[model samples]
Target: MLRLLALRVLVATGFAVAPAIAADFPPRPVGQNQAGIGQDVNYRIEIAAGPSSLPTVVGPVSRIKDIATIQTARDNQLIGYGLVIGLQGSGDGLRNSPFTEQSIRAMLQNLGIAMEGGQARARNVAAVIVTATLPAFVQSGARIDVSVSSLGDATSLQGGTLVMTPLRAPDGDIYAVAQGPVFISGFSAQGQAETLTKGVPTAGRIPNGAIVERQIEARFNDDEVLTLQLRNPDFSTAIRVTDIINDYTASRFGNRTASEQDSRTILVKRPASVSAARFVAEIENLLVATDTPARVVVDERTGTIVIGQDVKIAQVAVSYGQLTVRITEQPQVVQPAPFSRGETATEPSTVIEADQSGGQVAMLDGPDLQTLVAGLNRIGVKPDGIIAILQGIKSAGALQAELVFQ
Candidate 1:
């Protein structure tokens, strides 16, 4: 009895001290505090309530590199015409693809072999388009992967080797040379009356197949300002990112360094005392509370629906039902009695039926996505029905969110 009384007194004292401490603490900035900015974000965090209970809520924190990227460090697309050789009778026909014959003749002539013939008709060569992406700051002699696709009517490109093809950028300047054995993820086989194929045989890839012949001159270190492009453009997210970056830079380097240029772009001034790469590395690792707009994305083709947590509806009554129609064909043939002269015939019979599901009206005062979905589900609505209802709600100006259809 004495110990219980002492515990009660200690608990009361703890409760009395909590409010005093809470009142003295300063308020954090909007996005800098927990349960701010990204209330509807996808990331989750589990709060330790007790040993047996684990409840999760949406987390707002995200790294700079995960949400944004340096604008100048982008990939360049390079494409070229090439030929795949050494295929076992599974190549483009000379009569069908005249370009193949022309390319082969030109290649031989370049190699000092004069081809003075009607056509170099070979069933072992296939014309292909070689494509690769030149990475930023790629130096000469570095290798990159290339994709090869049949440019003509070729049966298959299995067991083929790509010839030396100069890959050029959009500016028409050669950047890399691709030549390697093609690696196909598919195979083709044929027997007398049946043929079997898996995956795509005419398209293949070669890992590290292209050797960089020329380097792209990118003076990244010389730039004084670096542009950060957000992967998903949003005004709230951009402002949050700028504030977080400025707060970090000001405390560490003694001045603000980041500013929001637009919803999709943020300009960060590189510090003169630090290298550009090091400064970017530091900025990219900093965490910020990201924000996303409330949206409902629906894919009609796949019957997929994604509802953001911040989505709300303004006191609407939704009524939903389904109409199903089924058609079945059943036929019975009549036979002649005692094998008499009568032609065999089939009778056509089809049964069609229609059903209408009972409609239910549900009043939804959705303050969040979960409540809205639960109310819709309570009315026994399918995904297609829910999509139609969402569209109707948007048209009626009842849904307080953007409705996106894909």
Candidate 2:
């Protein structure tokens, strides 16, 4: 009987089945060692035919909608002042945060309840600022998320309820109304000696907490031309986007309708035969490959290095090494012998040593990313050493990319 040898390979997505291998040699007897088999015998290996066990390749193309957005359709920011109540003695102190007390008195007066002349003293209320974003095309009565942050010295906002607050845009118009139970993911606990806290207890968010009260008019359908702004501005990417849009429009609509306005903007003329909304819906779904400038970013604090794909290094020589010095101190007590005048003293003994690793110069000339990494590895350079070497190469004008330090 023939024997079969199987091997398994693991991939990130999952495990793929490998073809089996057949050997011509017969199976060994039970409890027999491999050394018992004749060494002179030759075994033929065969693999059963099957599908390839390689992972699928993904291209760099992305939908135009992802890389660009309509200029007129953008979010509007809204802000308002509010109060959070129903706290378990973790609210702001009236003495330290006077705004909380004043807000409480004002709210009471508005509710037809008159407060005495004395100040309101309570540890269950906190002054807060409410913020929310009004999305484009949102109509009245649509709910959006809102965030609440303590405007006073409050310890926590957990299990607190925000009062009714009107959100106002920069144009001095109320856009939404937010009022809901504040949900915080953080908590705090204190004993006599120590306190423990997790996450941010002073800030919280409410999902679908704000209802839109007013709508900002966005004349999207009446536009004669559409402007697509690139998220990352690059000349090559802009040109590619223009070319792809024109190519698509010409092929489908029988006319070119796209032009490059600048390195960051592309203008597309809406055809009379097609509506503006339909034209944008069809163009934004097209796929285009993006391009970016070659750059190398280094973070010295974390010793991180990121190299772009188009980065290249000219012919250069690099050498890296580290020198370490160590010092140790030992003290010895000395005592005077017996009778006359006994005295004790301490003598300090010190030892010092230095170590320097050998560094060999490696010639590096990379026309691609893989070759550059291999050259750096051949020099036995670590991340820190690589950063220094890259900086040196940039200073020498041997690196053909932008070097950014963070």
Candidate 3:
């Protein structure tokens, strides 16, 4: 019985040792490593050569707003000074912020209040700067949103109302006037000696705060000729657009070169027999094939990597390891001799330590996308790790696609 018990213990020890030895064993493939893993070659081949035509669907003809003339497709910024009133003692102090006081006095004077001096101490109003964008083709009386930010030392703009203020474009033109109740996304509460804030209290937004008072002219087809512009100035896309339009026109009219200043603008000569509006409508509905650049976008802040379907990497081997360094700073004190005039002092002693673990060099034979992903996963690398690996690959000239860091 004693011999049998000893044999059982020896077998258990052998079983425990087997796993540790297996962990250090070199990696081996269960099957032959080859191309076309988890992919159907027959389907891929069919898609590559099958169709050059797009499906026809009924939709609105793309207009100028849907696309842009490259030159006119830009946003305009507007800024103006405004007042936010009705705050419950959360506004700027009159003594600290003189501008707030001046603005309030001016507003009151405009309402026919005759003050002894040109100054007033008010704690219920804040001087704010309003900013907004005047979109293209805005009509008269159209309402738009505006953002209000405190220009003074105001603690918060909560429960405030914006006075009438004119929003001006960069060209010094007053396009819209804003006036509404401000809605602050944050709140503040204060005790006798302390205060707590949840979000930014100095900025707020007013929905539909501005009303447009002027109209910007946007008239197409006024002349016998018009132009169609490409959003992205690609020569290939421009040629394709021209071809698609010409095909729809049945060669009745041909596009002309108006000027050398802009290559995107192609003049459309109106046919003598057809109405210009009808002809323009037919050209906008035409669909053509578009090609995009092969790109891989990485956002380091969010640790996101967006890889385009056409992105391909060249054959390469990647190995990754981590190095951690620890440093400790301990301060020591030295005491002077008893009855000595010298005072005690403190000294700092810094000890820097480093630790490097043995890292396994993962052999990656990335011939295609599937193999590349599998190889990266084997090393326990996630999105953040992949970001670092991609940066390294780009530096080493192993990545083939354009690496864009956003």
Candidate 4:
């Protein structure tokens, strides 16, 4: 009974002294501030909380974007195999890469050069895979970037040019034609005993190199409803997004236009009088307040720790400090008396020292992220120690947020 009373008194004293230290502890700014000529505004904290007594912050709030609202449409991939010409002894070897030689012969034959019997000797050419992304709603004659990669052992494509290559979609239909000067970002060279190389010369890109020859006409007409897909799955965010969109355009549409189909997607009923394009435009302009859950993400390699504002802590005490150990080697040589015919000898000696910091213990009244982190920092918690402390808190049921490690 006496021991228990003394332990209670010690804990009470720790609580009183800890808050004073916490008051003196300076918080390290986690974000960068821009140096601009503008007045600093007081923004309300928009953090979401669960059923707990987590501390609340009263400063600037972070804005979140609905990923689907900003995206217009998706792009399609078109691929084809063709040949590159005008290489300086960096072309694919015909003997080793048979497919390169076959492709070269086929393209040459199409250009009215009959290789029926004779060897179509083209050492300065290379077989390549041509690829491009056909952007959504791209019309015929529009240009896009294309990538050319050597299909064989080509040394360099410094000044090479891609031949007329037909890019086809999964349906085996030609959609675009690519032909441009290759922009190789690397080179290769061989010396007597050394070799120097930079960026990859075998694979290069041609900006605005392909011309679309066909178009896929799939317009978001008023007949069909448009679906909004969430980049990250969150039920609360999804429902809030649906309600905000409906509330904004409910009067104009005479009915709710948006509904949460699931956690990852939202279905918006196309207003008959308003076109789908117009409905999407209006939805994009409106901002939906986000209620993001608290989560702590840590990058172990770089020792990066990011804490959410609503991260709560339970009544727990943490004590931590730095430990240092040092060792030194010393040697002593012993010599015999000058008159005595004795050999000299050497002796080894060592000195070791251990030092530890005067770490303190503090009772964390974690109602919010600020006080919780401040208390830890006050006790000399370093980056490495912070990681361990957070893990311990989660294990001890003090931390009320998901701990994600990367």
Candidate 5:
């Protein structure tokens, strides 16, 4: 009896300490991932800095919109299985794709109709998968675009309407409903002689197609600080963004509120009595002077070469020459000259010419794109030859730029 009383006293002591311990730690507020409405005007930085000696050009200042966005306010993809109807006898064969027939039969049964067919053999029906992105902060009843692709052997989805399909997220919950007429980007027509096709006739898009039915709550407003994530990560660009925000915010608030987190993120502390949304808008509107790295991108398949303005080449020499070969069918028939018992014989001639210009050591000082082109033109070569020369320059450690081959 004494031991039991001791155990009961210990249990009572544990219960008494639980409330005190719980008071020390508070519950954390759950943050939702939601997108907010931004200005419709685009604030894009059309950077053509490295292409030439021209300074980095920033696009026109857009009104009421910021280029940078807060972290975690991203898009969510919702996908569904649906059926596209009204094809021109170019759909999945029931014998081949049993799933297509099964879908159609199930759809028909849902509409209070019963078909006693083993499998659907309709030539106008097709099985398709519908996909749409749910932007953060989108509420229910808002329309978004959807992309549909043929999941069966359907030739074209033109002039077809997608059946009511429920788009579900990764959590297996229905988020939005997508049902609209399919608009194919390309068309395909076939006859006995030949077939003509442009773009993808089986794939199509519907503008403002899927309706938003769920909300993604974000927690940017709850936190005392907000971070701006750059679309492209660069140390110089990140520093510039931070300085611009600090300069502007300090002028208004008399204190710097922004700090560079890393090469891609800028952390800004919300000021007293100012809303998080207002602070984010002010930071995004501030123009940043960005820098570019020297890079040379080339598409050999298209014979297109893009050289950066910062590209410099050490003193190098380039020499190019063309070689031509010719074969002439000049046959000479010599009759028995003066009938001296000589048989007629034919002689053939061949000619070859090699034109090699003397090599010259030309200095290449790439101060501007025009000067660079002029220096290369002095060698008088085609684009292919220019590519070879540039490759050689890079190999020789003369070209100071990152060469990217695409």
Candidate 6:
């Protein structure tokens, strides 16, 4: 009995000692696991510094519209066909790229040469399409950048020269001519049996390659009324814009209708008997505040979320869990007995594994935005994890603001 009692005491001591040893383990460092919280702030505001009001004499207050005219807010697109030459054997093969051969042949024929076989074998020339945008109010002889893309099977356009190409606008009128050396920031190299490449090889750009040949005629001062178009139309924003304009104009000229109608448009009455240019110059200097909606935008691909300041959420409980399923296939071969008239066979052995995380439901009675953010942070979840939680909450009709996912 004495021996038995001693044995029992030793067993109990061993059990307790094992747990005590484990309990004395060191704590993990805080830096071992940490995550950045919240979204980045990317908002900008611009304010004009000038007189806010001006007198109008040409039209009634109701006839005056916004100061920003449509002519100043438009751009023109130009396109042209060109040739890129002087490639290091990277130019399109004439036999494979018929268009390259045809283009070269046509160009040579125009220069008083003809090919009997209807094809030209050239290793230094490539057909390309050039494009550029002529900004509003561009003047003749101004230089503009242009993009050149090979229309053939050329491997690279590096160190190439672009022939003079006439760029045409949508109106089918030649407005610019592009001609310069192509600048390609990409390259390719060939090996005995393999090739390596970086960036785009067939596309390139020419800085200041296009010279404006014609100017688009736009007159902002000739109109008696000018229209101000809103980038984003909102009723409340429109009202605020109107009020700001009216206040500024009223101070200078009593009860001017420079701000009228919904915010979508504002009217500015040009000062009668004055040069249209001077009248336009006065109103363009006016300043107005703008507002945006309270919303949240999410890009799932990049795990990015942008939330406006006015976004809010209601009380809710959230639980996050992860499930993993793994499948492995092992192939096996079965050989028929030697001398037997049976063929060998193959089979696949499949193994499946499933794991479920130990998750706990968290109760959140968030009364404000700070509380909501804190509650979410306590779960130690990632952006993707939070996305699912937010989606669930929205489906349950708990989230207050709009949830837009892209």
Clashing pairs in 3: none
Candidate 5 segments exceeding 4 Å error: 1-67, 321-363, 377-382
Q: Check candidate 1 and list the clashing pairs.
A: none
Give a tens-digit lDDT track for model 2, residues 1-406.
Answer: 2222233332433523332222333333333432344443222212113222333223378889999987655577778889999999999999999878988989989999999888766888999999988887788999999999998899999999999999876545688999999999999997899999999999999999999998765567766667788999976677777777877877888777776656787778778888888988999999877877889999999999999888999999887878989998988999889884978999899989999884788999989889999999898868989999999999999999999999
Clashes of 3: 0
- Which candidate, 2 or 5, would have the higher TM-score against the true structure? 2
Measured by TM-score, the strongest candidate is 2
RMSD to true structure for each model, in Å: 19.8, 24.6, 25.3, 20.3, 13.9, 26.9
Which regions of candidate 3 deviate over 4 angstroms? 1-76, 170-173, 187-199, 223-233, 251-285, 325-375
lDDT of 4 by residue, 32-94 (tens): 221222553222212222222323434432222445533223466777888899988778888
Candidate that beats the other on lDDT, 1 or 3, i.e. the better one: 1
Cand. 4 Cα-lDDT: 0.71
In terms of lDDT, model 2 sits at 0.80
Of 2 and 3, the candidate ranking higher by lDDT: 2
Please list the C-alpha lDDT of all candidates, in the order they appear: 0.79, 0.80, 0.65, 0.71, 0.70, 0.67
lDDT of 5 by residue, 16-48 (tens): 111110011122222321221343322222222
Q: Which 10 consecutive positions of candidate 2 have the poorest summed lDDT?
A: 43-52
Candidate 5, position 209, lDDT: 87
CA lDDT of 86 in candidate 4?
A: 91
Choose 1 or 5, whichever is better by TM-score: 1
Estimate, for each residue in 164-251, the C-alpha lDDT of model 3 and write its tens digit.
Answer: 9998654446778999999988888999999999898899999999998764554333334554676755444445455455555555
TM-score, per-candidate, Cα-based: 0.76, 0.79, 0.66, 0.65, 0.74, 0.69
Candidate 1 vs 5: which has more lDDT:
1
lDDT of candidate 4 at residue 97, scale 0 to 100: 83
